[model samples]
Target: MAQTADDAKYLWQKKLDNGHIRIGFNDVAHQEIGEISFAKFPDNLTEVKLGDVILSIEGAKAVSEVHTPVAGKVAKVNVALKDHPEYLESSDEDKNWVVELF
Candidate 1:
C-alpha cells in the first residue's frame, strides 16, 4: 500500500562520515518492518528530490518504498545490499544506510 511521506519514517540521515551524508531507514522503520531481505537502489543517478523513492526494501513483515528525507546530489549507492541485505539489521545504524548524498 502506498502512503504519503508524512506517515512514514522512510529514510533518515545518518551522521556525516568523511563528509558524505548517509541515508537510510530510521530505527522505527527497521523495527516495524522486521529484518530486511532485499533492497533495490537507483542507478546512474544525478540528484534526488525530497520524498523521492530512493530505494525499495523487502522485509520479513512487508515490502516498503523508502523515500529521500532530504534533497541532494546522489553520491553513490550501497551496492553491498544487493547480496547481503541483512546488513540493514546491523547494530550500527550506519551499516544500514542505502544511499550516500553529497
Candidate 2:
C-alpha cells in the first residue's frame, strides 16, 4: 500500500550543538498522533542500528513505534517525557524530540 503523508514523515532529525542527532515526529506526525499519553524508550547508551525500533508511544489516536533512520549509541533521551508526555504535542522541536543519538 502507498504510505500516507504522516507515514512518509516518520521522523524529523536535527543536529544538536554537541553533534548528537535528535529525532522525533514532525508536525505532520504530531497532528496524526495527537496528545501523547505514554512513551517507551530504550535505555541510554543502548546501541541502535538503522531501522531499529527506538521508541513506542501511545497517543490520542493510536499506539505507534518509531524506528531509527540512523545508527548510533543512545546518547540521551528527553526524560521529561516520562512524566509529561504532552511535551510531545508541543511545536517546540527541542521539547518534542525523543532521543539524542551519539
Candidate maximizing TM-score: 2
Cand. 2 Cα-lDDT: 0.78
User: Alpha-carbon error at 77 in model 2, in Å?
Assistant: 0.8
**What C-alpha lDDT values do all the predictions have?**
0.74, 0.78
In the range 1-102, model 1's lDDT, one tens digit per residue, is 833333245556765847878886566776777898888776665698887877777888877777777778888788888898888777566577788888
Give the per-residue lDDT of model 2 (tens digit) for 19-65: 99998777877788888899777655388888777777888877877
Alpha-carbon TM-score of each model against the true structure: 0.80, 0.84
Off by over 4 Å in 2: 1-8, 43-45
True-structure RMSD for candidate 1? 2.5
